[model samples]
Target: MNYPFCIRCGWVLALTFASCYPGLAQTPTPARDTSFTVYSALAKARKTDPSITLARPAVPTIIRSRMNVPYCTASGRALQLDVFYPKARRQGGYPAVLLIHGGGWRSGDRSQHVPMAQQLAARGFVAVTAEYRLSTEAPYPAAVQDLKAAVRWMRANARTYRINPKQIATWGFSAGGQLAALVGTTNEETRFDSLACNIGYSSQVQAIVDVDGILAFIHPESGEGDDRKSTSAATYWFGSPKTERPDLWRQASALTYVGPHTPPTLFLNSSVDRMHAGRDDMMRQLSQFNIYHEVHTFPDAPHPFPLFNPWFSPTLDYTVAFLNKVFSRK
Candidate 1:
């Protein structure tokens, strides 16, 4: 018997089984390059502005780190994360933040954010840098599921890491920023949670830090599906052009999930307007719900400003202040 499959994700839709067990059918892995890194981003950014330099990872003596800790297993692969915390812990445990890297969803790894994580750790937060399956390995929801699983893992082992699980935040840059916003906005939404990891723990985050991440793939300001020249990153992740798989594009958008329950968010954007897609709308929704939020745009900064020096310091400062303000109230 020929079974129906989802054209968007290439998952076989065994209707009877899928309805009963939503997480049973995993997204098919696709062949793609995963070479984009902090160096690659720096190289590209330097072309536009030669003054830009890559942020090097530096573990201060005041910070303690555990490298390559397994967070969860997905599709028979162990997803690992690196944890950085202060040697001097807070009384009720330090607030935590998960840092995600941006590489258009096709490339980039957790190590890209190590510098920022170490800085956060030194500044009094338990920072975690996580590796999520990219578009090359699995499409769309796989990255989201992996990130949520990481949050669950953090919560489950909060005591061991000296983390205040209730005061966690998700922070991302570019593609990661989008994922961070999606994870923060979709709090308590079990559909995105994976059954294979930390089943009883919550993936809820108290704050979100989106640095130059597009909030919507289908919004008017979005340049996601304009692939006349070549296949766009959104196309690669969704496994189809936005025109063909608009449902997937919409579903993956963090704006689609914004509502009263959405947590306070900090939007650190560059001069690129396209990167700000759905941000204003999301802010409007948050305002309607009386939620706390902040937006700051560096006048002429590039999209990867979070990875460079002049802008990186301010980016870190804004993030620290936002997380402190949001968690201080709690």
Candidate 2:
């Protein structure tokens, strides 16, 4: 089938599904280099909506700058990942954190998550910020596949990057948070089994840091949410609406996959976001699974607040501490 084209950028996006597992020669295609610059995009997004603001770190980076690297291939398309690691501390391999960006599975870029990635890296972890296939080009699990491939790629190249292959964590904001939760909750016996290049390493994350990400597609309310927008996210990430694609929706839901072995998780949100129901539902599920999790509900923080404003720093501090605690253990 012919690939689709982006309306704004006129970028041709191929949607073919060939195995992107390691060892296969990557099918090459035109590189998508038009990703939004994180700083520029934030400034523009804030201009349209003053509620959004970029939060800067109080101190300078103790780590090296970003490393732009391609982590996956799909339909001849190359998806890139950016790595932020410590240049000063190189004696030992660091615990790793993969930062996924949120764009409703449609927009946003790796740069948007660079600050958080750098923050983690500066805190003694190898930070990997990745790009995935967007909904505008390919729908459903393509983005998930991109994330899976990134995990595989990181494991494959661990030594060179000074990373501990097993000490990996996935953290995301919004849609990316959902993806991180998906990685945290899923087991090797599920669909992800086929994608694992070798059983020696696992993609199960040590912890999941979710920032206002959706947990379940089974919206308890009827006609309450902006169906037009919500369904767009569901359809773009699950290939169909929750009603029509119950099975796939169930499979895709991170909440549904939580079990006794689920990695510990942290959720940050505010009362303003409509994800309260989903978040509550996820908490209940996690409780049932006996999973360890903590939720920080900012009084009036908006969605994507951490990346947008200074008020979100406390949450980032919590994230660094959470990483330190989780990685410090066996």
- Model 2 is weakest, by summed lDDT over 10 consecutive residues, at 16-25
The regions of model 2 sitting more than 4 angstroms off are: 1-52, 58-61, 89-92, 193-201, 221-231
- The sequence of per-residue lDDT tens digits that candidate 1 reaches over residues 1-330 is 001122223333223224433433344444335456667668878888898877764668998999999999986779999999999857779999999988888677888889999999988999999999876566678899999999999999999999998899999998999999999988967888964899899999999999999999999999887777655777766666777668889888899999888999999999999987999999999999999999999998988889887888899899999899999899
Candidate 2's displacement at residue 87, Å, is: 2.1
Off by over 4 Å in 1: 1-32
lDDT of 1 at 216: 95
Best by TM-score: 1
List the candidates' TM-scores in order: 0.89, 0.80
lDDT for 148 (candidate 1): 95
Top candidate when judged by lDDT against the true structure: 1
Candidate 2, residues 241-300, lDDT tens digits: the string is 455557876676787776778887888875545553367777877788887778888775
Considering only N, C-alpha and C atoms within 3 Å, which residue pairs clash in candidate 1?
A: none
Q: For candidate 2, what is the lDDT?
A: 0.67
